[model samples]
Target: MSDLVTLGQRIRHFRTAAGLTLDQLGDRVGVAGSQLSLMENGRREPRVTLLTSIATELGVTLAELLDTTPPTPRAALEIELERAQRSPHYTGLGLPVVRAGRSMPDDVLESLVGLHRALLERERQAIATPEEARRANTAQRLHMRTLDNYLPDIEELAQQVVRESGHTSGALTHREVGLMAQKLGFELVYVNDLPHSARSVTDLDNGRIYLPPASIPGGHGLRSMALQAIAHRLLGHEVPTSYAEFLRQRLEINYFAAACLMPREQSVAFLSQAKADRNIAVEDFRDAFGVTHEAAALRFTNLATSHLDLTVHFLRVGNDGAVYKAYENDGLRLPVDVTGSTEGQLVCRKWSSRAAFARTNRTTEYYQYTDTPEGTFWESTQIGTSASDEFSITVGVPFADSKWFRGRDTANRHRSTCPDPSCCKRPDGDLAGRWRGKVWTSAKLHAHILSPLPSGTFPGVDDLELYRFLETHAADTEG
Candidate 1:
């Protein structure tokens, strides 16, 4: 309801407290009882002169009468009921308007309000399906392509943050990450019992960021996650209301984290010198930054087109050959299903990403040149193991651009006629014909493809558990 309703309610409250009838107040204020009733019901706006007069008669200040709060608990319930009835969902139900009268018990009004709230929460909790998520990802990827996957504004922010953390050279230490957190008015707290749904929790109420110990394994390390969480606050991110916003925040945090590990100005200088020397290598980049092979290769893509005059492609494909992530500005065609999403699509077995898996010596990065319908491209793949599975991180450029990279002369060549079944999807004609009827093997299904994302404030996070953990920690702090 509007301020007029609360004004009238306050006026009525004072008048009743003073034991005056509406007509009596009208006489005292020079207004009609019918008009006072209209104003009280929130159906009419009172004039400034009338409002002043009413406040005077009620023996209350103008500010007191203009308070936006409903004057009483019953009034609050009444207002909520009125709003609930006016809502589209409620009106669409074709139910008669619920008039909360003086005779209506507060319990019934409270129940009605609770029901409406539940309805709204259910609508909010409806997580995006995989198809919707894919569509958002697809749109986000296309938008990233428009900018060549480089966000200069975020890069600048990362540079400022790193410099503030007292990082002048070499890898960013864990202590530096803590110092960074302190500068942001947060303490880094390592705990073993964090909510299973949370990789890291930023307890803004208590000025703490909770994360796993430094032993956070795999290519996505402890520092990266810490930086990414800090980036959220730095970027002014809110809880996303849509899949698109969620994906955008994820992309931004990652970009910020990468920029922090690989600062733009310094990284560009190193890459420029390497380009001039004709010996650019991912291993050297990884060593110089103290980041994982995957992180270094991925960071290269971020700076390649913008700083080095090179276009590149990157992929993180699982041992199962399903592509988890793919980005390219080099016109390398990747397989896609009907949804136009490269994620979860099978990589051609002949490509370096899949072929690197079969190599007996997996100690070092694998390099190869592939001839495809698009063009000849040179790719380097390194194996990285996560808790869930082993995946290959492949970074590649067109044949001409490969001359500047260190792994150009490996002599491992491949040809791929992707999107054609005969290329990699099917076996040889004779072998297929011989085994067609004899073999009846069951196909292994990937269950994740059919599942919807978990429902919560952040996807899959249990909000109640998070709140309870915070409460426990807050109590400890108070103690």
Candidate 2:
């Protein structure tokens, strides 16, 4: 059912329950019976002063009269059916909508609502196919590239949250995040045994967000999980019915959480100064915000082009030269499959993203200048480990703009002709001759190649576990 505030429904409920007819109530409120009927039908919005007079006559406050909830379950179903009929899905059917009146049976109303729900679900195209995921990611990436990956609306919302919570500078404290959650009408509860398939579970009925205690390996910190949970509601997200919607929401929440951490105004001012000093670096950004290096690097991409007039690219590549995630508009050619997807595709071995993985000292950031077929680019990479494997996060800019960066003068350099076999993919003449047609290797396949997304209203979550967890907590709350 739609969450629209139904003042008309509430008013109708109260008027009928008070044992008054439209004419009787209208007379007491000094309005015509026809006008009151129109107001109750939601055809005409009543003035606030009029609502006050009506409330007094009904022996209730204006606040109660304007409550968002429908007066009854039947009323809620009526509203949902009304909305569904008006929607384009029903309109496209070119059939006359049956008016839901007091005489309509509950079961009939239910059947129609269920059918409408199914129609909407079918419209989502069931984002379960392999191609759908790649298509969704490709579409979102292209859209992000067009906007330079900055979302000012989300930034504004985060700023309002920060301002209202009394956060000024430095890393956003856990206390401040709690305050923000409170302002959004939620409580963060740390718990053990969050389903293995879940990171966090939001109990909207109880206004509680349940998170696992002790940070999980390769996952973000406590604050990030909390903020992301809050973001799903703050951004007014619905249960995503499609893969595109799911990925978009994921991107948005991550962006919003990062903005809440660094904030746009302060982060830009900090980057502006760094650019002025010609020493812009991701490590410094990470230190200043006390965020993960990957977070800081990703955050920089959000502000780099939009705020600083610098075109940049970011890549998260596995140690095995697989491209995990990437963003670029600065002429760095990334490898992609036919679906315009870079995920799981291989980056050139000679590129800094892969080269940094081979470095002996993994503690320090690896800086390199790679001369690609397109142009010269300078990049800074940091190698990090997770339970799965080692990976690298890199941010790069064109050679000319590299002067404003800290590692512009790095002695490490590489020349490459990626997409050409001889650059790196081809074996040396001696080795090729010795091993030609002599090796037969079987490949170990990743699970994703065969599996579709986890089946549920929300992907990857076990609905039964989520329900039992909520039920247990609800019982405790009642106790």
- Candidate 2 residue 144 C-alpha distance from true site, Å: 1.1
Q: Over 4 Å off in model 1, which ranges?
A: 1-120, 215-220
Predictions in order: lDDT: 0.86, 0.86
TM-scores of the models, in the given order? 0.77, 0.82
Full-model lDDT, candidate 1: 0.86
> lDDT per residue, candidate 2, 349-455, as tens digits?
88899999889999888999999999999999999887788999999999999999998889999999988879999999999999999999987554443356766
Clashes of each: 0, 0
